[model samples]
Target: MKAARIYLSVLCLSLGFLFGFSPAEKKSKATWIWQSEIIGQDKQQVLEFCEQNEINLIYLRIDMNKPSDYYRSFIREATAQGIEVHAVAGHPAWAFTSNQKRMMNIVGWVKKYNLESEPNERIRGIQLDIEPYLLPQWETERDRVIREWQANVEAFTEAVRDETGLMSSVALAFWLDDIPTPDNPDMPLSKWMIDQFDTICIMAYRDRLNGSNGILSLIEQEMQEADELGRRVLVAVNLKKDMNDHASFAEEGVVEMNRQLALLPEHLEQHPSYGGIAIHDYRNWKEAAADMPPVDRDHYKGTYIWRAETIRTEKDEILAFAKENDVNLLYVRIDMQQPLSMYQDFVREAKAAGIEVHAMGGHPIWALTESRGKILKLVNWVKAYNQEVSSGEQFHGVHLDIEPYVMPVWREKKEAVLRQWMGNIEAFVEATKHETNLEVSVDLAAWLDKTPTPGQPDKPFAHWMMEQMDHTTLMAFRDQAEGIIGLVENQMKYAQSIDKKLVVAVETKESHEGDFITFYEEGRGEMNRQLQLVTKALEGYSSFMGQAIHAYEYWKNGKE
Candidate 1:
């Protein structure tokens, strides 16, 4: 019966080869590694190693903190090299928590990512690492725990399939051979798990194939069962030193590990289920020794500023974050005081790194008749700072964040304040162009169009601000993308007529400003997704430049 089973398994695998495996993957070796720590990787070096070693797949952790485009860039490059990439993550409780909302969260995120990503960048599969046996409740409630875990596994896999429409896989321990199921105590654990997931990554964790605990010994039966069931089998090795010494090739190092890995397929050549070798994680295996620069784009991606003090204090961090988010236009504050050099230094580096540094600072009073000179001083100071620095090492433009409604003058006489603010802005705009050819941009509340003009309340403030400045950053401030787009729709049409570029600004800062104004409650991922909606709505409009996130400090710390 065993011989017959092996023969039938071989036949099934042969058919799988005929119908399932991609020709490129079949011709190339199916080496893979898990990138548990993908943050600091030199993308080129990692891809080079994979190409040289014939690594066909990488199990990358979804960097939920970064934007979706972040993963898309790397995945696109990997797929171009004929390497497959899958989103991988696990937490045992994720599968069984009330509502299993966390599992749904993962599924939702991956689904959105796929929808936003290109064909090559879309995930090939989702490798779930829900190690239920590792949970504390498993030991005390063995039978019940096993049953719940089995159910969770099946449920989670189903969700991935039905929701994401992507192939699903799971990491399993090699010892899970014959643990009985609650439904049928005689059922093998391997059989049940293999049935639940499309591919089983066996955590073999042994260095050699001779002893009872050897890598081959552990998976010999697994491969046979895999062949019989038409399930794909992949053996994994631990690269970390803290694991059982004999369980990994940590002491032996990468050279020896690669040498041994080369011989794996040969030993299991006859096993129909043998797919490939997957190193446990990139972080550990990479030390066995050997290796993303960001991709540049052609867009005026920008951010708004409510905190120049924070930028000056945390310049390095702010600069790094700017590059991570691919920000080009930087709206920061400038003063002739103590931190003057900080401004110049920031502008210098920004120019060197192909980023624009625009000086930004304004008060509501600066838009009144008495304070017209004050706003000009800010602009003149920016012009002088530009002259002080090298030709390119200066403020790219000047941005005003003066919102007259915030002043008591507006309540006292709304139209009177509007007329005065318009007059002050007219003088400031003319002076800026006359003094320095710098492009002037102002930040305005998105509801400016809805706000009634003083005596002529029928005509919105948007009518009076025609060609008032080169660009306008509308503070749409809504957390959700749809609401934000709605806020800017009328302004977008007006801007196209007036020939002023409009930047739809969203609030990512956690502020008590308003309930729906800021995405402070939402993480960077959601914020990024929301921005995509803004871009899509206003795409192809010369007047619609791009979006501006509320501020850096709030966006950086909002996740906490």
Candidate 2:
């Protein structure tokens, strides 16, 4: 009788705990994307607003346009308020060569406000903006002008380093895929400028015509390409404008925020080569978010799955998991290596499964190499149905699969031959948007983190792709290792802080070690664990846009 009474008590207690206990709901963490448009009185108010609202990262433009005291006071105030100051040279006058007074003035303020020590490192870094005007593509005398500016900028940076020991960085012209444009082989100025700067910021936010808002994949392609030309690299995130503002953003207008947040972790996992993100301006974010609809995670879940490959089998597996677990989003992958005919069937099945698809054409390089115009023709075929296949029903984007161009022959002919290579893609993307209204995306090699082979000149590829593309899908699967994780963290943190839409391309491969450390075998369980960790780590920061698993087949096999 006593034993029965004890058992009943224990059962009641267990039931009580089970019924009463609930996991804490996730609080919305604010990303580092901030507004810089608040000027004069408005600026001060916004800074205070950020502080009150717990905004830790702040972006500002301290140029000739603003008074000297304005910048000094702004930095000082931001520091006191526990906000990190991320500033950019606003106008041409702030350019190192053109505006000596302004350059020195800004450097002095940075030195005063830039943090070196203890509890709060409020001032993160200074950004030297160098976006070229489209109207004046190249100036005959502009080369000389650039040369002068480069020298002064280097000197100014050296002065800052001497004082603070913190290396100064610059945001260079986002365009310029390769040095010595095919037209002017003698132009060493670009290369010279690249060498002078501590880190190169590739602005990967052009290519608006190729289906707006798919900027992360474009950034990845550029990062890989830039790896060819320069070693030290970072990327810029455009917090404003979703593919020219025609294609709408997620309800929260938090597309950039989500993209960067997701990107930083994934990039850290795959590519430690990235420095971080250089946000365009704080104001753009402020304005965009205000007009944004309240975040609907349900709709977010729907938009999240744009490419669901082999949905008939995979969709059911994913749906079962999502339903059982009450998960809203499911990561999907598709490859060009797979037959084009399978796409329609996959789409139909995915829809039935109640899964949203984020389809990326897995292998553009392989497909193009195999038939030259196969992808373009596939787009044509998809466009054949204007009804069932309204623009939205087609895959969310195409994933361009390009391996690092390691061959010397390929390197030498980069600009001349690759002009057509890029042209074909640009044309294909433009035509696709015109027809399907779907965006195009691409995957890039995580090659930038390593040094280029001694003989290769264009090793850092981000320098190349930044010139043309806006979206990038980066492979960031190996970043969790201790040696690599720090690099990954810093790079992703920086990317998120800057506000670019970046997707960390995670690999479904795993690791196993017995006899080999450097070349150990990979496993499936490890890949799944890595994905969960990467996603969890990148929760709050902006600049992340979901993730791209290495391949659909790899993921499916790993589960099996």
Candidate 3:
């Protein structure tokens, strides 16, 4: 009998492979479309999004009131693009025996729709998202509620089993494994649900992947149970903004979310029952993606204007030089002592010439605890200036070039200096938090990634700064692209993980520090050539914004 069973398994595997239905075939990428009317409103939008995201399966919410043509047309188009559409409907109240009819109505509708539609337009599956745990009765009469939920699920699955080609699935909470089955105390509710449904989508919502409470760990039991039963399980993650940071990737942006999702296959492919990943719903996921800042790779050619007097004395010459060098960003030094009209006129012209002007000021003393007021003074001055100027004349952002390491106190009290620097940054960010349009950015040394935070040894100071600011300009200050890339590699990875931006800056002024530290000796052609190489090399990193020259004076002089 054992030999016969082994032979049967081999035969089944052979047949599955021959028919292109092997259990180890390509994993399915699914998503939920909770708004049924979206199909009737703009079906092409949904189809195109699915195509771009490589979604092969969709649990489309069913609204029986709509005309059948909507589903037919959407499903037919999806089918042509190798996508499957499944009818989905359910509510917490549907778990009650009295609401059994409401549950049956969905099964009945899907059956009727599939019967009338052509092969390509047919509904491929039915998924019920009933969550009895959300009902108050489940808390008071837990046993009774469990019995009723099980009965409803049994009935629903039985009804679906009669259908010819329709599969049955359920969106189940990952914690259901802790609940014992009413009929078989040794079995888990999750296991029972897996047995009853053709597929189970474990709602294992989490932002990270490896912790005790992460997505992988939360769905381990469910995946094991499904594999033992030879069933399929799709891991689901929430993208809704309503969820906490740990529960959803809404705040992490699309690039980080994709970075996390891309690792699911490597960690899950070993399980025979691992189906794939499913995003919570379409609308929120689309909105979260849209919120991400568009990456204009290699687009920003920037240089600093360190002297405010230069903008007044050589306004036309500066604009002409900026245009000639394709400079889009100018970190113009803010001299609070100078007249505000000088900055207003210069910024207005810079805007007209298609250049973004950011107010810049910094000193090594600004990192001292006693000098925190100086940091806030700069922030307040920029804020006040922005409020006084027209939109075209306002500073686009505030950029700080503070190098606290240059202070003598940094050598005597390194940790104290780091703490004070962090405090100053916090003050700057707090001062400008209310300025909705004003971006807060700073210049950071590339090697800061090696310095650990005071208490959190695992997190680098560079990462913490990236988390607090809108973006950071890394002072790589290396003449060659290879050296510059190596210097900023760790910070680049951290920036990508947190969805922050980094602009790599190279020194052009002759440096007494080291020959490798500045491109001043390399001249304009070599600097431009090396920067182009850096851009091409770091093209894969979404965090890499572009390259920046140290200052307009030296760069322009070198060009001469």
| Top lDDT prediction, candidate number | 3
Residue 231 lDDT in model 3?
95
Give the winner by lDDT: 1 or 2: 1
Number of the candidate with higher lDDT, 1 or 3: 3
Candidate-wise lDDT, in order: 0.72, 0.47, 0.83
Model 1 ranges with Cα > 4 A deviation: 1-298, 305-312, 452-459
Question: What lDDT does model 1 reach?
Answer: 0.72
Models 1 onward score TM values of: 0.46, 0.39, 0.53
TM-score of 2: 0.39
Clashing pairs in model 3, backbone N/Cα/C closer than 3 A: none
* Model 1 lDDT per residue over 216-245, tens place: 887877788788888787888877885578
Q: Which segments of model 2 are wrong by more than 4 Å? A: 1-57, 63-83, 93-98, 112-122, 132-137, 179-192, 206-232, 239-253, 256-270, 296-560
**What CA root-mean-square deviation does each model show from the true structure?**
24.5, 26.4, 23.2
